[model samples]
Target: MRRWFMHLGALVLAGGAAAQSPLAEFDPADFGKVVIQPRQSTSGAGGIAFEQAFGNYQNEPVIAYGEGSQAVRLGRPVGRLDMLFEDGSTGFCTAFIVDDTHLLTNYHCIPGLPRDGVQPQVKAAQFVAGYIRPGHGEGVDRYTVAPNAVEADRALDYAVLEVFGDPSQTYGRLELAGVDPEDGEFLWIIGHPQGQSQHISREGCAASSPAVSGEGKLMHTCDTLGGNSGSPVLRLSDKRVVALHHAGDSRTGYNMAIPMARILAVSKFLKGAEGLPAAAPAPLPEVPAGACDALWAEAKGQGCAGYGAYLASCGTHAFAGLARNLQASDCGTAAPAVIHGALTVKPSGGDFPTLAEAVQRAPYGARVSVWPGVYSGPVYVTKDIEITGAGPRDQIVIDGVMHWSRGRGAVRGLTLRQGVAVDGGSLTLEDNVITSPATGIALRGGDAVVRANLVQQTGEAGVSISSNGAVRVEANRITRSAHAGIEIRDGAAPEVFDNEISDGAQSGVYLHSGGGGVLRGNEIHHNAFHAISAKGAVKPVVRGNRLHSNGYDAVRLREGAGGTWEDNDLSGNRAGGFRVEPDAGNVLLRGNRE
Candidate 1:
């Protein structure tokens, strides 16, 4: 016989009252919204419109779980996980304790499993339990997740990790249900929605009959958002975990989750009836001395005729080890014809026909040389590799976006037509000519070195850095940008020095939205707007630059902007040298000659 929680309706009414109550220091902007793409309707008949489906949505604060109720007790194991990536960006997700030393979360939240010598992108991760609201909670405690002790499956969209401090001993863990939830069974979800205080979706949450989708995901109607990716879906009847919420489609009025039973079927952590022991870590493979010499001899013996086949026979791990050995050995010199250990890409009749093929086949930390030809666009680089063009920049072109997402690498002596975007890694982009329909270079969450490049005629700013992005912009020629020559926003602080910035439709350099950086020894002139414009909580250090011959003022600081300006040559402008608005926060002007 199944037992259900009584007074469910009363609990929901109490939840509404709690949600309406205001809390201190609750800033909506601090929470990052998870953007979910609209999925095609599974039902041939178009589902109810999004407006109608969510018109009476019933998601309540976790406090609504009620005092001394089973809902509150079961929610004790849920927590908010904060992740710091290798690129210096931070993100948050939801997770729950499964065992004394283990926690469970979505695979997408922690994609880097520690097997096969692959390092995870997440540099650090911590879980905070009882985070009921901003600055408010009940017995809140924080624990760190061990980076090396992670078991994950991308296909299943789940990860089981060992928490270093064994947090479950204090909060207890949720028990997985032996059977799947029945059709139309009432369920409830508890998680941090949009990185806010924990919330519960229970009023109208229910499991659909025949809930399993083609991908083995359970379809349900639960109010969820971006940070709710790893929330536990519990059966109201028994308070046992039944599913792991992963995604939602507002258009179809349905959310998807991985059934707990399905995850248990393949979980190595938990074993049959009597739980089995966790597997021990595997030993590292040994690379014998002269391994690189032997591999190079084999490739040369084949006359490089079957280089692709040879790479496959060597295997990714083996070749990666060999590449390391070669880098450390004396045979690492660049040969005039066919450099040893470096893959060559040409338009035709080379080691690889395309740059993409060469990059994909190259082992970790390998070098790829492109020989004076027009390669295609949208080349995605995920590892550390140096790609250099053989001839002049204009002769070697990549017609689309060069997206760098992980590791550290460099691209030199090439002409990039569309532009470059770095979101999750460090890239050194140097000695290149770049032009684009949009911003010539966009940096969101990574570090980049933009040096010795010619950037011109972009649809937007010549270079843009935003949202925790760190870049060193130096020794570049920037001109004819549709907007500012360099635009910085959203908490980004970069170093700008020794560049020629001119002929922009807007300011030569614009800083706003809490952007700040050091601008030194640059020539800024001939812009449609001010030479430099700072606004809205920005505090940049402007020093030793020749800000003259512009259409507007040399510097304009307004709307609470504050910065240090010293030793700048401000003359020959259409407007005055400096315009500091009364509302500006603070300005330090010294030795600036007009």
Candidate 2:
């Protein structure tokens, strides 16, 4: 996600210089990678276990219908990543050649951003191509990663790194598809799962429908594990790279990948195939009131006498009716009175009977206000609009899922039952009460402002930010979560501050799996676990927070996790204050007392 902690001025840590030193000798057994457990799914539609399909490569079982000859050669460019962190730890991921010099992988695979005075955790890394089987390293081409030659976007969860040598000349790089994969289209993944030999997951793997896929991400039923983080998802029909496989969720019974198109749109080091569709033009900036007269004169010069004529001539213009609306108005006191489209949803005698109907019928930039009543949902928002509950939050409730994908909007003053899921775009979730069997507010691949809300008793986290979600959680009270009060993982780095979080079954604030962010000025206590817990390459900035009376240590850092912890009050914790595991990396502790 977005880098929230910028100036980490003069970090002070114990054994910091030693942790930053290069390893004198490399030992495979000493450094270890995080092993992500495979989430089990009872649904037959879920991914087939890796053991069942490609476990015995000698006699690969036919896992899907219409068994045919497989294109095993497509795995040529795929490779396993071996990384050595500065902390003397190691990890492995998957990567593939995208061009002659550059390779594509997950940002989390090399989750290091050397900024200001901080250094990247990865001291050195290499890519091993053509490692087809365990103990079969002969003939495999190894290339070192070019120093500081990495371009990554945490929000997109993709990285492009230059290799020291042109290994693609031998293996050949893969071309990215210009478009997203069609729903239900079969896809293939070639990678090193669990750091094993190169294996292709093709049988029964297909893209999920758009309704289920969300935005900016392609959900698929592909068998993958921790080491498969950066695998390229290839379209079975054209054999073109369509997405970059990233994380898997057992709760959803699908694995998630970053769409190649989304990555190409913002990438500076990579380009899409020829004939890639052009992006939509950005909306024009708002016109100033002082320019109204000049604009009106220009319109009149074009043979447009009135506002109606000007609108007819330039209906697509951003200021189509601005001049006419402000002709006789003072710029300061009598500004243009602009009217926006508005719709109402009520139990009866309103523009629409259901919130879903109003949202579907409302045009972009419209307002949909809900009256006092419980509304049944599964409301899918796909346009830019504001949805506000006109009555009290509890009086106007949404009793099911509210899914917002590829839309920018605000949802305010409502009591939500099954919770809200934001997949992409920017959304403001404010002044609402949310309760759910799962996460009260789940964000993936989007920017959201979650402020001044009450989220309680979620079966999962009260607020779960994952898969590169950029969120600002402020002034919220979260309690009684079955999991963490706020769970951040899979490269999400949210800015969380000024919140009251308590009574979580897990940590009040839990971060792991390349997650980092700034947690400041929060009141966190009475959790079953630590008040704040971080692990697995995370580096959150925890400062100015009152943390007390937790079941375990107030703060715990393990598994190469390190960050700046400053001026936090750590008192009355059952297991003492700060506990850093032996394998923990460089943690900066300044002005903190137990």
Candidate 3:
């Protein structure tokens, strides 16, 4: 008795045209009808496989009998359930065996059963399992798990019941299917489909989709109704119970089952001592090439330990385990081996051979340990490498310059005397001291980030940004330079911020050649030229600065300089606070104290 609807043309109904096609008699009274379709083979298989398949899933069989119903058979009878309410009325529930001692059903199957949360509870409850056709009255047997120990995932609408009693009361255990069945596989459900222990059983083939009402790992068909909310949907191929029958589809002839895998994942039955099945083990991923060599290189007897720790101490290395593993490998005087993976390395030899060599040997996503020493070789890095000192006192010094042409790079927590230049890579230099060079750090292409570093005693500009490289220079101390302490040229957007520039031969900060930069939060004083000079510069934001004590004007904007000058404290300078000539447009000034 499945629900099927069809709409024909008005002509057939009015008998105005063509012959009348005989259709099934329509009845509004039989709104809830059950339909059983013939089984068909569906061959599609193998998407997400499972660990184990279900075995024989029947414990104690039950029988169903009613006025409108024919003879029905239940695979495993979830016997009488005891439903205790807050009003003191108790009713028996339908209980099905998942294993020897575990009972499976909907969480709402037994209302007012307080096993957890902040609720009042009693220690006593009744369970009834096995039932048979009495030939006259209700058949009865003992097939119940007691105490209903735990509940979980109430949002999933499922629950597990733990029966605590003698084992002789039950016959056998019910098995759960490991994976989803074929599309058209035969499915069966046995439960109290109308609050009657008449245990109705209906056989139907799996449908393409849910029957329109039920959802999430459910099947749509015309086979079930109320009181069957916690029944089992079993696959006959291996007698496996796949999903817990939760609800029926209202739109079409269908019912829904919660997959066994999800139940097994969150269930804690096997954790108890009541002879339940254990969970399947997890699968492992494939190992990479030279995995053993890489592992051995990170083992003890290596000389590279404190390098990663030092980087972490300076906020240079984001990942900490890489440093510990590099210290464990034995670099064998050739060079310090790179530490990749999750282990710790303790290098037994001296510091890394050279910064460049250390970078070349370390893994792609790892840090190289550079102990405190004067490293006088050129470091051309191509990957994201972190080079750090051994300790504050044991500093890692680079006596020579560094050159990077491609890829991205980062240099942190190390002092450099020679110069550093990046041509194509995105580079970042942080928390270091650069001295003696004409330019402390220079970038020509890609992007550059120079932050929290000291650039002092340079014959030329302390830091220079050129060659179209978008540069961000912030929170730095630049002093004692022959020319401008900081210079932006070659058509780049240079952000100069929060810096102290003093005692320079030329301007404290000089902007030229169409430089698009922001000059803010700077202390510019004691310079030969203007404290801050913007000549032929474009789009410069000059504000929030202490500009004074210079040989020329406190701030100078001339020669078509497109910039802003305001909110500045220009005090005790030789020339006027600001000297803005003609041809300077898009300039704004407000709230100044000179």
Candidate 4:
């Protein structure tokens, strides 16, 4: 999540200190000096949900064996199987194998939807597993299940169906991944939408956060429609089904899936179902040996590099020991290759000893811990490495020096200053404070996660990612900048969540050139021009945010690009509650107020 602080000129708000001049409408062209009272509603979005029911069906090959009668049970043991009722009419829904005898679907898809908090009909359905058209499509298979014993969560808008049957024999079981995938991992959704295709699957990524409280999970991207209810969402990494699709806020094009962890928790609450035992924790794969040896070797090679003479130690034994202990503990195993060595600056070497040296010494997929102190120098890395503090509170300050250049790298828990450049690479800079820099962080690569940092007093944009994989920016404070607080270039899908961006020169959050992303659960206030600017950004979702006191439009959409603005309160922006430029596309503006 690359973000910046745009200058919104200061102004006075209702009940705030009286301005030197009388109150008047705000002018966005000169917003940098404005101040307004807090607005209502959280400005944020939701992401995908991971469900445990379809653990194996999500990621790996599945093989199950059972008869239609044994595969599922709905409304007593005997009734018409593979049929359901909806909205007082007989509407059909399909159920596939979540487990041998377990099914899943939308709570509303059940025969009896909760009407006025009471069941109007007996909530029951049937299951039909291994429905294959022999000879016509020998290899293609389909399964059906009706809701029999159903448990639903209206807030999450999903339900779990338990069928009666020996699933191992009736159908192919799937391999479920137990871990959440890294960003950029390929993901797929399988189900019927609009009653068009059977076993239809939608592909996306484990891309794009919330505050610490699951705002990110509520704001994810997926192409789903009304009929996608009860579909299983699988990750390509481990084939583990993680989420169950449910309700979505169409305005932001952000879909919500119930995470598997929650389903398991809820399932436990529904224990005592016949033939079902407590859900077992899924197992993760083992890490190979000598995975991080490259880092140690690289560090030694750098120590020998001719850099006016510097000494640093690189080894793996300590790291290996830690890995073994971690795997034995509750946190699970550590990737042996993910360990990184520490590099300390020689005394009087200035701030950051030499970021160039650290990069040269660290190997791909390794972590490099930096010892704290002030060092005036620029740094650059070309490999995948985690650069973090030796220990929290141990500061490595880079004053008046920018770490320019790039090639898939990460910087963590360090202070940076002017001259920092992030040209490319799988880049991530977190837990750092940046001040007075040409640009706080600039990215041209994909697959980045930037979080938990302070970026202020910069001469240029605070954070920018023009291209690459999904970018997620969360939990940061950006104030008083020369340029936009956060600039997301068009053609990149970024999720910006939970940041306090105030008092900047231009727009607080600017999306240009088709900035297709979601802005949810944040405070966008007191900016010079527009609080949120969607210039050529298509279908951006702006929700649950507090937007107040901007010079121009509180939220502006231009160039035929549209966004869904919902559940947000707009006030004192000196313009309309929401403004759409001429020729803008279908930008849904709902659930918002002035």
Candidate 5:
């Protein structure tokens, strides 16, 4: 006999300080209307009589399923989520499966969402498998849920669980909708409403709206009660889950659900999920262009302050992406972005009238959105701020250095004509293209991470580091440099990995002045000098590199430099493989393939 399985998570009213209270409000009446219900039940009897109170009415049909019923196939995925908390109070909600082993429910049904996607609450709870009617003539088949299989997001009021076995192979799994159901589409909600056995609200349930006050949410007329908190809102046309019912308004009989689109965006547990439906059309919000020229120099900042308001004005639709990212970081409460967290800047006309003003006016750690156009001035980054291009990386060009100071921040998707120079502080640069006549990145500072970038035609080195902080240079391509592709000195420890260095006028990399770190997974070729040159007290750990067709020696460890080189492809060099000077001490070079 096939059994419909459900692996549920835990739920509780979490404390406020650690997890920010959700700005989005949900009426608790919709979560579970029945109170103090038993954790276990076998008979399909109503836990208690539906009381006649407070002028309540029901236009929806609570249809019970039997053999040859219309809802038998549709109700298979809908199973009971029996949760027993540490306080010894047992609560049961509804959950459904999206895959062979994964189930979706409400975050309030499982309070503590693991940042690491491991569900520890599953072990502390039980699941009443196949608890619905038509299949419940025998006895309740209880399944013990394993630990670390639940993932929850309290803000969205949703939780996903991984079952121990392949249940999708038996009862089958429901699909998730990327778009909402068209108007008048029939909807079905199956759950143990009012703590009763699972029943289907086959009629008087459909998607309606004036969103229950947030982005990517649907207002549905699903007759739900307490235990229905995690029930799936299914679109009858295709039978895909459109949303997860969370709360309802008792005064209006309107219920709200978290849209599946938002769930697909925010849930880390669904990363790289295949066999899912296609994504619906999601357009980026439009941003206006600007001039950061003489007209705005007099004003400290013009129109720039209004950009934040404009971005915020796009409503919940523009905020879905931000909400997804925040939920992944376990911060669902901070949804519906506050403009106070970000700032807007323009090139020469729109906001601030210049890139310089955006830098000067933006608060520390604030995200600055710079519109497209050639901003012909150096941006002095004095504070820890993140500056992003409103358009493509090539569309937003800064003809001067994005000079860094004692600030720590990130710079992404910007084209720096003169390149970047960070003198101090912790800085991370990613996906940036630097076309400089001098140096692409002159990092005299500490704690820098330069990754997935392109550096071209440097008058000096492609990258220069002279600090003591832990720096990481990963997945970067340095080409056509007038000097070395990379230089590290002054006792700096920089880990350079998975970089492509070629066509440089000098060595591919240089380490001097006691500098030391790791250089691995790099493609070093066609340089004018040695592929790598280490001197002084520098002793780096080098491994897993391809050094080929260099104009000079593959590696030169001279003047007291010692190195551990292993697992490298050393071939096609014009000169010798490596040179270890008499005073450079014995270097370890092993596992190299000629």
Candidate 6:
């Protein structure tokens, strides 16, 4: 049954009371922001553009299943799923149980999420049978996506995955149609829209265009939103799936879906060749010094492709001595640790009200504990001290720029806004949510530990450290950054691991111009370009990351960059798996799990 929690204007819990609520139950009429990667308008001239609303675009949103009591009447084929990934990243989308364990969703929804370098990274799939306001408390049932059970087509945009157990026993399965829906047929689109409850859109929505998208896709007028990516657009008469909802026009007139026939065909083909391995990792070949010298000289002129035949010529461990010879500067000098156990500047007892004020008042050897509230920043701390929050990270928010000027400072349990710049300090940032301006954590000339932080939507990088990249970025969830997730550039070399970085406009982790580092066990996927982009005379040890579902190469090297690349899961990328520009120096590649 659909559980109605409370109204938006007057939300009253059993004991607690909130004047306003964020739940969709109170305001279900408006859908949230569409989360798909925005595409260029097909609405312009000579584009596959669509414009003008096809039907009444301004209708009151109808609550699906009427608060869950009508679940018996509505078909049980469609439902909502919340995908949980390693590194504590989460996403929601729509899906339908197709077989005992098999399920259908858009490829974008589950792209490269199943594996973390041959290991299962997607931890669970929480299914909300009657996905209403989760705050009302009960209706979520979670199932794990089975390891190596993902099959997808990036171009066509459809995926078939197997759940850990049989969802068919509870939700039942949706039947597939081999036939196409006729244009103007009544299209009943049912799925969770905007991460709200399950919704059904039928007001003036119909199958309008046939094959308007890549082969056999149907364009319709079904109202959908971000979380509705994998919605099943069913024909009203029988409730069988006609198309799988994928993309929508931002102009509010049209949405696109892959036909059910195409999805079924792809599923059949994938059933046989699932978990296909990547090609054998090619190592640097054995060559005479003169030959290697000649190739390098030619590559400097023509490019790396000039010696393409010698994949990694110059012999294994060719650059090992060179990599070891480089020294970390005096910037690696040790700093004093922050003194703990002193309480100062809190909401109640301390002299100051804000975090910045507290840090300023506190001596070099004291600790500051802030209360649960939005603390304004430039919370610049120059003293070697510890700054903590009252409770969980979500409750204590620092709403401005945070900077650590002095070395050996610790910050915990705070959601920082704007961004943070730490230089000449050994700072530790943990359990904080940080959005960005330019870079989320700009660690210039600092040795820091950034652990378990949620960094998102940054301009330059999620974590951008300078020449002295003496930092450890681990277990952090970074997404939708304009540049690299962890940009170790200009001679910085940091240890980056266990981070889930996705949808980055540039490489997941970029190593540029004398930067050298180790990238291991990081789930780097769905980025616009390479998972790891190495440039200049840098040699990074890139290993054991799930580098897939990317637009370009899994790893890209240019100019004089080379590295040890091995044991990564590379598949389903738009371009070839890995590449090295002809001018790139010798790259030692071997034993990668493709």
- The per-model lDDT (C-alpha) reads 0.71, 0.71, 0.55, 0.50, 0.65, 0.63
List residue ranges in candidate 3 displaced over 4 A.
1-348, 467-470, 583-586
lDDT of candidate model 2 versus the reference: 0.71
Weakest 10 consecutive residues of candidate 6 by summed lDDT = 3-12
Question: Tens digit of lDDT per residue, candidate 4, span 1-594?
Answer: 322111011111213322221211122222211121111211112221212112122221111211221111110111112332332322333344545566655555553344335554433344433322211223323333444446776545456666665443334343333334444444566543322233334334343443012542433455544335566566543334555555444344455666655555555323211121112122223233343454434433553231111111222243433332333243332222333333343222222245556566554345455544455656655554566653222245666554434334567767776634555445676777877656676655645677888888888877775765657889888877678888888577788899888888887888888766778888877888888887764677888888888778888887877868899888778775688778677888788878
Tens digits of per-residue lDDT for model 5 on 439-466?
A: 8999887568999999988999999988
Clash count, one per candidate = 0, 0, 36, 114, 24, 12
Error of 2 at 592 (Å): 0.8
What local lDDT score does residue 140 receive in model 2, on the 0 to 100 scale? 70
Cα RMSD for candidates in order:
22.7, 26.7, 26.3, 27.2, 18.4, 26.1
* Ten residues in sequence with the least summed lDDT for candidate 4: 3-12
lDDT of 3 by residue, 1-594 (tens): 221111110001122223322221112222111211111211112111110011222222244343212122224335434443343322223456655456767664533223224242323444544344433223344423454446645545576777655322333345665565556666666654333443544333354443222334656342543345566766544345667765433333344567666676677662212121222122223334355334434432343443432322321233333443343234222122333331111122332456766665554445554444567767777655555543231144787888766544467767788777778656778878887556767777767888888888887888877757667888988888888988877677788889888889999887788876778899988988889887785667777999889888887777777676779898888987877888665678887778
Every model's TM-score? 0.45, 0.45, 0.42, 0.42, 0.45, 0.45
Candidate with better lDDT, 3 vs 4: 3
Candidate 2, position 3, lDDT: 23
Q: Tell me the lDDT of model 3 at 165.
A: 58
lDDT of 6 at 469: 42
Candidate 2 per-residue lDDT over residues 398-502, each given as its tens digit: 888899885567999888999999997678999999999999999886779999999999999999888475689999999999999998889888999999999
What's the lDDT for candidate 4?
0.50
